[model samples]
Target: MRSFFRWLRPYGLVVYWVMLLGLMYLETVNNLPIPTDAEGAAFAQNFENDLSRNVFASLIEITCLYLILRPWSFTQSIGRVVGALVLVLLWTSGLFYVAFNADRISNVLGIHLLWLVVLNLGLVVILIWRVGRLLWRSLQQSRQR
Candidate 1:
């Protein structure tokens, strides 16, 4: 276990960025409306159904990109963790929104929205664990040094 974690330490940022990209892709792709119906008109109408989901999806992608590229000062690192946690909470809330408003999400877009919620939840758990482990290891290394 120690050896695995040690190996991960050097590549922690890389792993995090990869996971972030994956989450972004999942959220963006799943939120997009894919047409399965014979009527091409329905597909066109789907995009107009609701802009909220797409807006939030874009926000998430932008935030993820900022998290990956922005140089973090000590305080900023803490803020980033907190911000990530908040985003996860918001995504979970979206799940509840979908649950209560099932009628609003009965179409293809709705299914994709659910997928995005589930995927984001899993990514959140992985990210929290990874960040916790990295912080613990960093503290340990500092003590040893």
Candidate 2:
């Protein structure tokens, strides 16, 4: 499993965002009826909308990915600190988005709610776990000295 993530680490955040947004675009556009004049416009609009709606979510997911992969284990303490700070900022942005866009949840309940809640909840858990792990390691290192 770790090896699998190692293979993925090089692809980084932008690749994942493109893949996520592409999948989202396909999902949204594929569900529609046959277009007589303008499915392109609709698809474009949906791509834009998905891009907008998911900006913070994408940021959060990439940070989660970095935490799970933990490449800074190969580098230095500064890398880890930078990664953690980036993760916290992205996670906080996601939280703020939810707080500001509460009504969006009801726009498509059930599955949508599950997607929103589960994804954000999973991110929160990952962020907490990574931070805890970092702190524990720091404490252990300090005690050894």
Candidate 3:
């Protein structure tokens, strides 16, 4: 854990947190003092969708974080394979999102996204290491038989 943090950039994390706060503020803007009912309805729908998506994303991310902390917990648990694949997809999509929208993100958040890129990379590194460990263990077990 300490080593992971050492490998990840601390300043980028700080920037990310600050950007989250800024996003929170931006979320509230929703064009206050609406001029018409149509605008109000649009705002409500947009807000609800964004809020729901954020909640869902948070849940998935938290679950994946737990797996990252206990990679071996899923070893030999065939039922968990689907969940693992979902996480892999999530991270892959996240990376693509960042890569495709780097300029837009920077313009909105006014900060470099290197920290986020590094974050995804770190998670991927853990996944690779975990897979390697599992393969080695399985190979050793086969040799012992």
Candidate 4:
């Protein structure tokens, strides 16, 4: 875990932010249909119909969050911090879009509320386990000293 942090620390936060934003932008642009005179509003409606893509986009956002937050230490450089803030704006915007359109996505997916509840609960459990593991390792190291 220490080695993981050490390896990522040098890679710089800017790289992570760029990758997140770039992938998100690519996904959004690629999936969204261009509104033509004939197609008009229907183009957008078509894009909204794909629940799988919506879920995929949300997963991308989650991955981005994981990458950005993985390092316990955010950044050593002020420049990187500023860059991350900018990237965060893009990330938040994407999240907001997803949140607002969640109903539509759920409708398209034909998923029940219980499933969403279960998924969130599962995530919580995973997070708790990871934190516990980290804390246990830290305690073990301290005891060795």
Clashes of 4: 0
* Shift of residue 130 alpha carbon in model 4, Å: 4.8
Sliding window of 10 residues with minimal summed lDDT for model 3: 104-113
Give the range where candidate 1 is weakest over 10 consecutive residues by summed lDDT: 68-77
The C-alpha stretches of model 3 lying farther than 4 A from their native spots are 1-112
For candidate 3, list the clashing residue pairs, or say none: none
Compared with the true structure, all predictions reach lDDT values of 0.54, 0.52, 0.48, 0.48
**Residue-wise lDDT of candidate 3 within 7-98, one digit each (tens)?**
44334334544555456446545445523354343212223344445434444554564554444344444334445545655665675676
Whichever of 1 and 4 has more lDDT, that candidate is 1
Over 6-104, each residue of candidate 1 has an lDDT whose tens digit, in order, gives: 666445545654554455445445656654566543432333434456545545654573564353332214455556557766765776686566533
Model 4, stretches more than 4 Å misplaced? 1-5, 9-13, 24-39, 43-130, 134-145
How much does candidate 2 score in TM-score? 0.37
RMSD per candidate (Å) reads 8.3, 8.6, 9.9, 10.9
Candidate 2: the clashing residue pairs are none
lDDT of 2 at 39: 40
Which residue pairs clash within candidate 1? none
Rank order by lDDT, top first?
A: 1, 2, 4, 3
